[model samples]
Target: MTRTRWKFARIIGIIAASILLYLLLGVKTYLYKASVFLPNAHPNEVWEYVADFSNMKYLNPTIEDFEIIEENGNYNHWQYTVQYKEHLSHWPYLPNYAKARFSIKPDESKSKFFIKSFHTTCLINDFLCLNSESEFSFTRGYSSHGVHCDEEIAYECPAIFARFCEREVKYQRDAIMLNLKRRFQ
Candidate 1:
């Protein structure tokens, strides 16, 4: 086949795959919840570390850029764009130029921290997901050994993108937790 023909064939294949993926995904939203525990870390210390959104790019290098839209002491509303160089853009976890927002606030007693994130836009050279919301709670507790810290997150994403988005989101969360655990350890 000619080079032009090969390019055309590849484009067609991509379109067909996208259509098939959309069909399989349907129109719906999915919620994903996860929990992770950090050892040797106080709740307040962990909360302070996670709440600092600016430093997240270092924690998760996939973040291309991070900005603080609003801030109030430990409580902050922030936005960041992610850039991933995965083998396939359709992998969901590696959306090119994905944008998201995150913020959290702790309760009066400073025992529990509440977090909310809106993954509003995902672009693969084009607009993709409309919206995905994730709410999280971080708590500092005690165990027989010492400080016991736990964090839970509830995530909601469009079904069409969930296959890809969920995996990427989980990877990001897991990476963050692993780093945090290592720090406290």
Candidate 2:
């Protein structure tokens, strides 16, 4: 083999090895599923709390502002601008801005509330790659009602993406419950 050809082979091998190492060790683990029980508030009240888009600033800690640019009754389509700071193990904390669309629905008789949020941010960190759009839906119910929450994140790293989805959903749910508790108290 020629010297140049051997060097090219060595370089390709090194590149492949580096990619494998990144996949194995450079990926981050994000929180995927989480839930909290709010004892006193009913689903209807929770729905009302979430329905008011402008109230997001009070509910979400990381949200700098939530404006309802447009809406139509139960189905409200609006833009959400959020600012967040994250700390990695070896890197300095980084701040990020994200924008998304939100939809909310309420079933008064059944005492159930549903929320859907779609975000445009695809990548959270260097190792966490979000290849697909982000979406989350949460259902809150009263005593006899059914409560559920689901989140979907399309990414090359499902494990890490799942964790991030879980944390995001949990934060929104908890925020609604907290607002309801405060309002009634």
Which candidate wins on lDDT?
A: 1
TM-score of 2: 0.55
Q: Stretches of candidate 2 above 4 Å error?
A: 1-5, 21-31, 75-93, 122-185
* Highest TM-score model number: 1
Per-model TM values vs. the true structure: 0.63, 0.55
lDDT tens per residue, model 2, 1-185:
99999999999999999887766555343434334344555555555565555666665554544444455553333334333332222222443344455566554455455565554443344333332243444355445543443344432334424455555545654665455456545
* Tens-place lDDT digits, model 1, residues 1-185: 99999999999999999998877665566555555676566666766676566557655645666555444443433333432332222353644544556666667375776666666554566555456676666676555232344444444455665677667666766666667667777
What global local distance difference test value does model 2 have? 0.49
Worst 10 residues of 2 by lDDT: 83-92
Superposition TM-score, candidate 1 onto the true structure: 0.63
All predictions: root-mean-square deviation over Cα? Answer: 8.4, 6.0
Q: Return model 1's CA RMSD, one decimal.
A: 8.4
